[model samples]
Target: MALGLALPAAAQNVDGVVRPAWAPSGLPDRVVLSPGADAARQMAVAWRTDARQADAVAEIVEAIDGPAFESRARTVDGLSTDGVVRGGHGRYHTVRFTDLKPGAGYLYRVKGADGWSEWLSFRTAADEAAPFRILYFGDTQNSILSKGARTIRAGLMRTSPDVVVHAGDLTGRSHDWEWGEWTAAGGYGYAMVPQIPAAGNHEYSDDDDGRRRLGPLWAAQFALPENGAEGVVETSYYTDYQGVRFIVLDGTAGTSLDALDAQTRWLDRTLASSTARWNIVIQHQPIYTCARPNDTEALKAAWEPIYRARNVDMVLQGHDHCYSRITDGDGKASGEARRAQGAAQGPVYVVSVAGPKMYGLNDRALTQPDRVAADTQMYQTIDVEAGRLRYRAYTVSGVLYDAVDVVRAADGTKTLREPVESLPPLRLCDGDVGPDGAPCVGSAK
Candidate 1:
C-alpha cells in the first residue's frame, strides 16, 4: 500500500505532510504595556483580537538568559463589543495582565483560537529614583499611517522611553481602520513601552441609544490603571514612576464646573499628597494653546490655578497641531507685559503634534512663546534625572527644532534652559493656510 493511502485526509507523509498554512487565529494588534502602582514590581499588558477569540489569554515569563526564559502564564477573558461599519459588524476583545513584578524583564504572549502570538519582551520601570525617559506624542489622529506613523517611528528610534504619553486624539475617528492605522503607527514600540493615553474628543461616539459611549476601541484596547478619580473609572488617573507623578486629566469630563470641581478636588489632593520629586500634568486640551486663538478657558480656569499652586513642573497637552513651550521668563518674546504676567517658576506648558494635521500658529505664538513651531510635525523626548529634566523637541526630519531643560533646586525653584538654535521667523499669513499649505486655523466656534 502506498504511504499516501495510509495518511488521513488532513495528514501527509513525514517530509511531505500536507499541513495547513499557519493562519494566526487572532491578530495580536494594539499590544501595550501599562504600569501598576509599583513601577519596579508590577505591569499591565493589553491587546485586542478578533471576535472569534472571545477568551483572550496572556502568558508572561521571566527572562533568565536569551530568548529562552522561565515564565508564568495568566489568562483573562475580555468583554466584546459589536461595532457596525458600513453594513457589517465586527467584534473586538481586550485582555489585561496585572500583578507583574516591578523592574523585572518579562516575556509575554497572547493566545487566541487559532494560535499564540510571538513572544514579546518588556522590562518594567526601575524602582523609584531610577532615572528614565518618556516619549511624548500629540494628536496622532489624522493620516496616522501616511504622515503620523513615520513621526512616531522616528521618535521611538531616537529614544527607548520607559513610557509613552499620548495627548489624546489617538485616532481621527472611532472607525476600526482608523484604530488599525493608529496601532500600526506605533508598530512594535507600543508593545515594548508602556503607554499612558488620555482620552480625546474623538474617543467618544454616539451609541445606538443616542447616549454618548466611549469608542469601542478605546478602553477595549488599553488596560489602564484603575486609580482614576471618583465617578470616573479610567478617564482621569495619576501614576507615579521613579519619583515623578504624572497626573492625567480628562478635559471632557472636567469641562463642566461640577465635574471640574470634583476633578479639581481630586487633583488638589493628588498633588498635595504626591511625594514624587517631579510633578507633570498631561491632558488633551491645552491651557495655553499656540495654534488656537484663545486658550482653553474651562481647562485653564479649573487646572491652571492648581498647576500654579502645586508648582507643577510641566504641562503636556495636544489638540492644537502647533508647537509651543510657554515658560515664566520672557526670553526671546518676553517684554514688560510678559514679565509682569509670567509666573515666576510656574508650570511650563508645552503643546505639540506628531500627526499630519497642520494648523497655523496663533498670532500670539510668535510674540508669546519661549519657543514655537508651526506647520511642522514633531514629537518630544524628555529625560528626567535626579535634579534635572531635559526636553528636546524634534521635527519629523530629525532636526532639533526646539530644546529646553529645567533644573530643580532643593528649594523647589527651576532654572530654564533657553532655545539655542532658532529657526526663521514664522511668516504670518492672512488665511487659514499655514506656511506648508495646510489649513492652520480651525473653526473658532
Candidate 2:
C-alpha cells in the first residue's frame, strides 16, 4: 500500500538534502563581480567550475540592443586555482577586465567544461564624481539561505544599488557549504552587482597546527584589489567608486601584534591621499558596541583618532547582532542639540546585523544609538551625491525603519539631519518575549 516501497533505505537518505543548487559543476557557477582599485575603467569577476575546466576563459562585449553583439566579443584568459570543496575537487577562476569604457554597460560570460554560462551584464563606474546608490548589509553569517536571502533581496530589489557592501561575517564558519549558500541566496544578482566585502572574525579558522588563518575560499572566490596594508593583502583592500573611497580593514588581523601598526600607518597614508568626495571605512568590529557590554576599545584606541583626524564620513561595521547608529561619540548631548549647536561632527559610526542570529541590547544601547533595532534583520541604502549623503534603513519586508541625511558644507563640515517623518517604533524584546509577541530567539550578552 506504500508508495516506492521497493526503494532502498540508503538510497532514500542521500546527501542531496544539504547540497546547494549553485554547487560547482561542469558549468560555471558562483559568478561574482568585484571592482578594481579604479572601477571606472576596470572590474573583475570570479567563478567556480569542475576540475575538467582547468583553464579560466571569459568573453566580454559591450551590451547592445540586439543579440548579435557577441560578434564583437573578445576572449580573455585568466588565472585559475584548484581546491577541494565539499569533499570534491573543483577549480576557481578569476578574470579582470581592464581598459573598459567608463559609465558603459558590458556583458560577460565564462566557460565551463561543456559550454559557456549565460551572459551577465555590469556597468563600469563613471570617470567623474557622480551620484550613486549603495546597498549595505551588516552580516549574513547564520541562516544565510533561509533568512538572509529575504533581506538581501529586499535591498537589491528596492534600491537597485550601483554597488553592495558587506560589513563582514558573511558565513558562520566559512565552510564551503556556507559560501555556496551565500552565492546561491544572491543568485544572479551577485553576477551583476559589484560587491565590496570586509573580513570578519568568522572568516578565520584554526588550522591543524592550532594557528588561525584566513579562510581558503576567500582568495579563490573574490578577486579584490591588493592595495592594502602589508601582510593583509587578501583580507584588506580599498576601492574608489563614483565619488566614494571605500577603505576595507580587517578587524581580525588588527588583533595581531604588528598588523594593527602596519594597518594604522596604511590607513593614515591612504586617507591622506584619498581624492574622493566622500571617505567610508568598512570593517567588522564596531568602535561603539550596541549589544556587547564593552566597546571594541582596541579598535577605538587605534583607529578612532585616525578617523577623526582624516575626517572620515562614516564608519560602517558589524558583529554586534543588532542595529545602531551613533552620531555623537560622547553621548552627552541629544542629536538635535548637537546638530543645532553646529558642533563639528566627527565620523558617524553605525553597527548593524542582517542575519538570523540576534543578541540583546546592552547598556550602551540606551545612550549611543540614535536609531536602534533588536530581533530584526535589516539592510541599509546610502545615496551619495556631491554635497549630501542620504542614508535609509529598511526591514526585510521593505518597510522604512530609519533615515538620516549628512549634509556637507562648502568648508567640509557635516551636519546630521534626523528623519523628516515618523519612523516605526523601536523593535526590542520585552524580557523573554520578542517584538512579535513570540518567544525571544536572541541571547543576552
Candidate 3:
C-alpha cells in the first residue's frame, strides 16, 4: 500500500513500508536544542547515532569571528541510551552544558561513528530581564515534512525567535517515520533554536498492561528540564527565558491518569514562587476549545483556577486543529467591549494549528472566540518585553491574520489591545464550503 502523501526528502517507501532516511547511522541527525532550568547559564542538546558510536562525544567553544576558534574548543563527554524503533536501532545521546557565561555566544558539534557534525551556533539567554521572541506552533501531527515544514521555515526566516514552543501532537501516532519526517521538516532550525514542548494525547498510548505511557522516542529526541510535578516530570516542566516563566503541563496525563491533583498543586506552587515578570502556560489541551463540542472540562477544572489566581499571562494550547484567541471565558461579550467596560484582563488563551489536519469550529465559535479560523495552518510569534508582549499570527504563506499587544502597566495590570492595522476576515466554513471555496476538509465535531 502506497502512503498517499509526498515522501520526505530523506525517506523512501518500499514494500508498503516507509523507511526513515535518517535511520541513525554515522553522522549526527535530528540534532535538537532544549532549554535548561536556567536558560542563561545552562543549555542541553540531544542527537542520535547508530550503535557504532557507543559514547556521546561533543565539543564546544566560545565562538569568535575568526576561523581559529576550533583551537580553543573543549571536548565534552555525555551519556547515551539505547533504544529500538521501527526504522532501526540506535543510541540517543544527551549533554547539558553548564557553568557558562550568561549572554554569551557559543558553537558546538557532536560526533558520530563516521565523523563530526557541522558546528551549530547558539546564544545563551541574558541573565537580566530583557526582551526576546518566541515562535509557537500547534500540532505538526500530519503531513509534517510536506505541509508543516513550510510554516516552520516561514517562522524561522520571518521572526527568528530566540526560542520555540510546541503545543504537542507532533506526530500522528508517534511512529518512527513520523518522527523522522518531523526532524527533517525542521532541519537545522531544531538544532539552533531551543524548544519547549508540551505532551499531547497523541504522545501517549496504552501499554500491554493497560498503563498509559509516553512515546518511546519523546525522551530521546528532546532534552528538557526535569523540574516539574513529581510523577509527570518528563512532560511537565518549567523553563525561564528572559523575563518570562514558561510552565509546561502534561494535559494528556492529567486528564487520563491519576495525576491531576498533583499537577494542580505543583502548578499553584510554581506560579506562587515565580519571579519572572510574565507567566505563560504551555499545554496540549485548550481550556476553551474551538473545535470540540465542549471544552476540555477535566483539565480546565483542574488548572484554570490556578491560572486565573496566579495571573498567568497566556495559555497556549493545541489539540483543536483550528485557531482561536479567546480572552473572555464567559462568552458574554467581545474582547473590545470588555476592554471598553474596564474589565480586568485575564490570560489570553490561544489555540492554533500548523499541520494539514483541521476540524470545523463548534457552536461556541459563533461568539466566544475573539478571533477564530478553520481549515487553516497558522503560526505565531510573540515578542516579550518588560512592559508589553506583542503577538502576531500568520498564515503559512506569511500573511498576517491577527495581531494584539498585552500592555503591562506599572501596577501589574494588563490590557489587551489590537494593533492599528486591520485584520483579515475570519477564515471559516461557509455552510458546506470552506474558506478557500474547496471541499471542506474541516469536519464538524
Candidate 4:
C-alpha cells in the first residue's frame, strides 16, 4: 500500500529501530483522545510532556460561544507515568472525565512546564442509538508521514466521522521517530476524533526469554476502555459508541502474548449480551487475508464461528498490508449471485493496509475476495444509523473505491446490500513497471 519517499530526520532510518533526536518537548506533543466504554458518560485523553513535567493536570469546561467560560470549569489531576522511550526519559499523562453530559461539546487542555496546551474541543456521543460516522484505517506502518499521512488527511477532509478506528500497526517499529511522524501525519485528527486503536503484532516485543509484552509506548500513550476479558485487559477491550458495539481483540494467537482463548470467550459473551443494533469486531491480524499466503488459520478456527453465530456485521483487520474483502461463501461459486438465492449472511471480513509497506496479493486474491487490491493505500468510512449502515472505501487521494449498504431487519438481523458505484481501474504491475510507471515495488510473493 505504499511507495516510499525520502524520509525526514523526524522519521526512523531503514532499520526502523534506532532514530535521531530526543522527543521534542516545549509544549505537550502527541496529544490523543479516546472514548471510554460508556462514551456518553466519560472520556479519556493522554498527552506527552518532558520528564520534568512529572505531575499531570488537566481541565475541562463547556464550550461557550464567547470567551467568558472559566466560571464553570472543572480541573482534575491525573496519574503520570515516566519511562524511557528510544533511550530518552519522558512522562506521559492521562485523565478520564466522568459524569459528563451526553451529546455535549466540551473544551479541555493539559498543562506543562512552559504553560497549558492549546484548548481543544470534543463532543460526546448521544446517550442512545443515533446516526454517527466512523473512519477506519489499516496499518499505517511504513512511510507514516511521507505516505500514510496523506491517507489520514484524506479521511479527515472527506467526512465528519464521530470516531476513528485503527486496524493496528500504527508504526512498523514501535519507536519514537515513527510515532512522531504518525502524530504529525494525523496532527489534530487524533485529538478531535475519539480513537479506537487495536494492538498489532509489531506493537509487541518478544524478550530474550521469549515473553511478549506491549511496547513501552502502547499502554502509556492511550487510555482505552477496561471492559474486556479479565486476563487480557490491556490489549483486549470493547467500546460501545452510539448504538454500535466495537469489540477489539489481540490477534497474536500463539505468540508469547497469547490471549486467544480469553478473547474468544469474551467475544461470545459480549455479543450475546449486546443490545446494540450493529456489532463490529476490530483486530490486528486478519481472519482472511489477501497479502499473506494464507489466512491466520488460528484466528479463523477460534473466532470465525463466534462471529457467525453472533451475527456480527463486520470484522475490520490489518497487519496483512494488502486489501481484501471476503464474505461468506464468496470464493466457492456465484459469490455475488449467492444473494440471488435466499440465504442468510454473516460478518464481512476486511483486510487493508494504509502505510507504505506493500505486499503482493496472494493467488486467491482474484477469486476469494469480493474485491482485492495490491500495493495500494486506502481508507474506509462507515456511517451507522438506527437500522441502516453504509460503508465506503476510498483511495489515498480521496476517490471512492468500494462500498456497501446494510439494513437491519425487524428481528435484529442485518443484510449487506451492494450499491452500484463506479471505481477506478484495477492496478497491477506490467513486467517490472507499475501502474504508476515506476519500478514495481512491494512483494508479489
TM, every model: 0.84, 0.94, 0.95, 0.93
Give the Å error, residue 434, model 2. Answer: 0.9
- Misplaced by over 4 Å in model 2 are 1-23, 85-88, 256-258, 332-335
Candidate 2, 1-445: lDDT as tens digits: 0111111111111343435453568998888899999999889999989889989999999999888898899999999988575223488999999999999999999999989999989999999899999999999998787777777777777788898999999988756677777877677788889999999989888879877788888888898998999988998889999989999999888984348888889999999999999999999999998898888888889999999999999999999999999988777357557767778778888898888999899987867778888998999999999998899988878789889888899999988777677798988888999987988788878
lDDT of 1: 0.71
Ranking 1 against 3 by lDDT, winner: 3
Q: Give lDDT: candidate 2, residue 95.
A: 95
Q: What is the lDDT of residue 313 in candidate 1?
A: 94
State each model's CA lDDT, in order.
0.71, 0.85, 0.86, 0.80
What TM-score does structure 2 among the candidates reach? Answer: 0.94
Q: Across residues 1-445, which tens digit of lDDT does each residue of candidate 4 receive?
A: 1212222355455554444443546478777899999888889998888877878799899898898887788998887887475332478889988998999999998888778887888899889999999899999987788788878887876776789999999977667676778777777678768999998988877779887767778877788888887677877888888899999988863334466777888989999999987899999888888877777888889898999888899999998878877876358355566655756567888888888888777778788877777777899989997778788888887778778887778887666688888867766656677667887676865
- Candidate 3, residue 396: Cα displacement in angstroms equals 0.8
Residue pairs of candidate 1 with colliding backbone atoms: 40-102, 40-103, 41-101, 41-102, 42-102, 61-71, 330-334, 359-440, 360-440
Per-residue lDDT over 1-445 for candidate 3, one digit per residue giving the tens place of the 0 to 100 score: 1101223465534343535575668888878899899999888999988889999888999989988898899998887888574233578888888877789999999999999989988899999889999999999988788788777777777778899999999987666667788887777788888999899999887889988888888988888998999899889999888888999999988988889989999999999999999999999999999999889999888898888899999999999999999988876376677789887789999999999899989989879988899999999999998899999999888889989899989998899877897888988888888888987798778
Which of the two, 1 or 4, has more TM-score? 4
Q: What's model 1's lDDT at 292?
A: 76
240: Cα error in model 3, Å: 0.8
Cα deviation at 326, candidate 2, in Å, is 0.3
